[model samples]
Target: MKAFIVYCHPSENSFTRHIRDAFIQGVTDAGHECVISDLYRMDFQADMTEAEYLRDAHYRTTPDVAADVRAEQEKINASDAIVFIYPVFWSEAPAKLVGWFDRVWSYGFAYGDRTMKTLNKGLILCSAGNPIDYLEETGILDSMKKVMLGDRLTGRVKQAEFVVFDSTSRENPLREENWDKNLKAVYEKGKSLFAAK
Candidate 1:
């Protein structure tokens, strides 16, 4: 299987980076090919220009889409699965990723007369500062899943999942305590990414 990983993070000195690496390691170990888009490293333009917005707003596919967005769409069509790795901010994905959806999921590509392929899987792995119980209790986890899986990835992938490693705040002792365990789980997720299908 080929997995296109969209990783968003501002720094390498983060557990999120380690999770991404571990997931990649497991993917390779499973004998699968993977492509990555390090949004921050690539300095991906998340915000759409006025022209781009107008094109989408008007549902015009006449003017060619931006080369960068086209490239991202191409990647989606080429891959069998898509994985998003990032941190949860304000109960949502980082603004850059939010922008990624705004731009990459262009009107014609991700919707109307879409050329985008329906992939085998779509997975989201995000870290949160709050504990899992708290997130669940507050319905934040469900909301996140609904937004990512029910909305963004809906109809785009055959299967989808949202996993969050919580209690990862720098101030939380569980952050250090669960580091290895969390990474192991991430690796296992990668190794088993294609197992169900």
Candidate 2:
């Protein structure tokens, strides 16, 4: 199986970066292919031009999508699974990633007589500064999942999963303590990505 990993992070020296690497390694070790779109490293343009806005906001369904957005759509069509790796910011993905959805998920492609292929899986791996309990207690976790799985990924993939590695704030002792465990868990996720349940 082929996996398209959309990794969005500004810094290389981050736990999220390590998660991306480890997940790729596990996938490759299991003999699955991997392709990555490192948003920050690639300097992907997240902002939509006026033309784009006019097309999408009006549900124009035009084929005149930007080259970058078209390229991202092609990647989605070519892969069996889509993996999103990032750190949770303000209870959501980074602005760039959010913009990716805004632009790449175009009218003619992701919806409205869509040409986008339904993938085998869509998985999200995000790190959080606060504890998981805190996020859950505040209903932030459910909200995030509803947006990602219920909205963005629904009907786009055959199956989906959302995971959070919480208590990752630099000052939180759990960051160091759970580092290895989290990485291993994500690695396992990669290894088992296409395995029969």
Off by over 4 Å in 1: none
- lDDT string, candidate 1, 66-175, tens digits: 99999999999999999999999999999999999999999889999998999999999999999999999999999999999999999999999999999999999999
Give one clash count per candidate, in the order shown.
Answer: 0, 0
Per-residue CA lDDT of model 2 for 1-197, tens digit only, reads: 99999999999999999999989988998999999999999999989899899999899976499888888999999999999999999999999999999999999899999999999999999999999999999999999999999999999999999999999999999999999999999999999999998
| Structural similarity to truth (TM-score) of each candidate | 0.98, 0.98
lDDT score for residue 37 of model 2: 96
Model 1: colliding residue pairs: none
Cα lDDT for residue 177, candidate 2: 99
For model 2, which pairs clash?
none
lDDT: which candidate is best?
2
Best prediction by TM-score = 2
